[model samples]
Target: MHATEALRRLLEHCPELDRTHDLVRQFASMLDARDAAPLPDWLDHLAVSRLPALDGLAKAIREDQHAVVQGITTPFNSGVNEGRITDLKLQKRIMAGRAGVPLLRHRVILMAGLRRSYP
Candidate 1:
């Protein structure tokens, strides 16, 4: 059976999976059948309607790629690192920053080790 037909059968039996599987199956069939059957009129209309949003997304991706290539954007999870830094800042404030860096480092290390040992 064609991929589309198999997908239709699967979707009919398991509607809970949503349309993602059907879309993937349809895309694969489209790639394999190159110049085979044309898409239905409804799908063509939907694609036209979504073209602008897709183009914007493509543009954003290109800009992001350029930034990465130019070293303008650091490849790091700033959000996660910032959260850790914020926790460190809170620790410093609680101790009024009176603990030297070494003592602070030792405290953090001990806390992490205790968490791991207990957890």
Candidate 2:
């Protein structure tokens, strides 16, 4: 089926989904514009949306609302640090009980070098 036809049929059957789609689009617009001004209103709408999953999400985000707003407004992120940590964890798991610290250190250094060279 075509995408629009399928979507139209879905909205016909589950009207609440239209609200969900609108809320999602609003949030995406906020992100694209790097604006958190409308976030509180968005949270309020989500909290009363009567959708259990989205309500839970709204609660969780409210708990860390400051961090979420900061993430939206700032260009700085932990992506590089997170990638490095993931690389280290994967290497540790791969070499578990099979190698010593020296080998692990060598592998980590090589991985960092490769990442820098490629990226």
Candidate 3:
């Protein structure tokens, strides 16, 4: 299902969760409406306050300058790394679930390193 619809379903199912989910759904709807255009002024302001480094980096990019913007606009994400770990777990499960902790740790580390080096 599309992200907006999925989010709507989730909100419908859990009406008492944190409000951030609703905000996210609204943001997604805005993006869909605008074809994922640049964030609107209000959203930009909110982002700037919440993430100063991103605001600074955006300013620099606007001025045709580049600099290390750590803590803002991370160059990589841990999602792929987490996925790799999950995949490793599944593979180990197929092998009678007998992989030792050390071997699993080594395999995950090696795979993460390789992914970073190649990707």
Candidate 4:
């Protein structure tokens, strides 16, 4: 495809982009595999890659290194809780100026019960 050819030419012209792309792929694979073993080495490489954006990400991850490692190694996650919060926010927006807090609370509780029933 045209996009593929363009990307190939771009990577050929910019070796740094090629390196960054490989690093990004590696990081994605780590997340998919739920493995943190390579994280520290990856962070070190990213920091010295001279790429400002990736360097900033490395710095932020280093700050929360423990949480990151735990998240990677554990099966438990905040996904369900986050989904409920998102649903609550959307419901709030939809009902804004149209209903009272009592109505909103009732609807959220109903929805939560429905989710439990189906899931």
Candidate 5:
């Protein structure tokens, strides 16, 4: 049988997997909808579900619940900040040991914020 068919049969027999699947879907929907209000209920269920595999995930979300909520609700993200950090790190490594602070700074200033020519 196909993998999906096997999983379907297994899920029919495994109530735990069924519950986990439903909970995961609800969590995914909450993320897509940026709805934080339902997070506590979901976490509560996850905690009592006793799924040892997901303990770390639960812990992280609990520790950063506020940030998680903000992340879900806010349109702002760290993409730009991460990109700039990457660019700066790359430029610094390239210029390392060859230049002093001023030249390194100049090179970083010149290289960053510009698109690479791929010709």
Candidate 6:
């Protein structure tokens, strides 16, 4: 009936798949928790699980261990700055043929709500 039920039916006869599913859930919960404390144990499990697909991921996690921890521990990110830059680029592209630098500057200023109203 549902996707979850279908998946359960599919994995019902496969012990290996059930084990894989458990490992996947554990990793997912660890990621959601954003605490690297379980990472070491997770990595060990990954190695022991003998899943070739996760080998590259394990290596990547090991290589970027510090950055990953910082990402999980800190609430800081460049998302806002990146979004602003993306908006500017899109605006520039949309106004490319219809206008020049001066109009583009005015549009950007207006879009940013920086244009002053006439008194």
Better of 1 and 2 by lDDT: 2
- As for lDDT, the candidate ahead, 3 or 4, is 4
The CA-based lDDT of model 5 is what? 0.80
Better of 3 and 5 by TM-score: 5
lDDT of each: 0.55, 0.92, 0.57, 0.91, 0.80, 0.77
Model 3 lDDT, residue 89, Cα: 81
Per-residue C-alpha lDDT of model 5 across residues 9-79, encoded as one tens digit per residue: 99899988988888899888887998889998888888788787656677779998999899878888897
Instruction: Give the candidate number with the greatest lDDT.
Output: 2
Point out where model 6 deviates above 4 Å: 13-17, 78-119
Candidate 2 lDDT over 1-119, as tens digits, reads 99999998898889689889889999999989999999999999999999988899999999999999998888888989999899889999998868788998899999999999998
Worst 10 residues of 6 by lDDT: 110-119
Which has the better TM-score: candidate 1, or candidate 4?
4
Off by over 4 Å in 2: 79-119
User: Considering TM-score, which of the candidate structures 3 and 4 is the better prediction for this target?
Assistant: 4
Model 1: runs farther than 4 Å from truth?
1-76, 111-119
> Candidates' TM-scores?
0.29, 0.65, 0.30, 0.62, 0.56, 0.56
Q: How much does each candidate deviate from the true structure in C-alpha RMSD?
A: 12.5, 4.5, 10.5, 5.1, 6.9, 8.2
Give the 10-residue window scoring lowest on summed lDDT in candidate 1: 68-77
Candidate of highest TM-score: 2
**Clashing residue pairs found in predicted model 1:** none
Q: Candidate 4 overall Cα lDDT vs. reference? A: 0.91
Q: How do the candidates rank by lDDT, highest first?
A: 2, 4, 5, 6, 3, 1
lDDT of 1 at 15: 52
Candidate closer to the true structure by TM-score (higher is better), 1 or 3: 3
Q: CA shift at 9, candidate 6, in angstroms?
A: 1.6
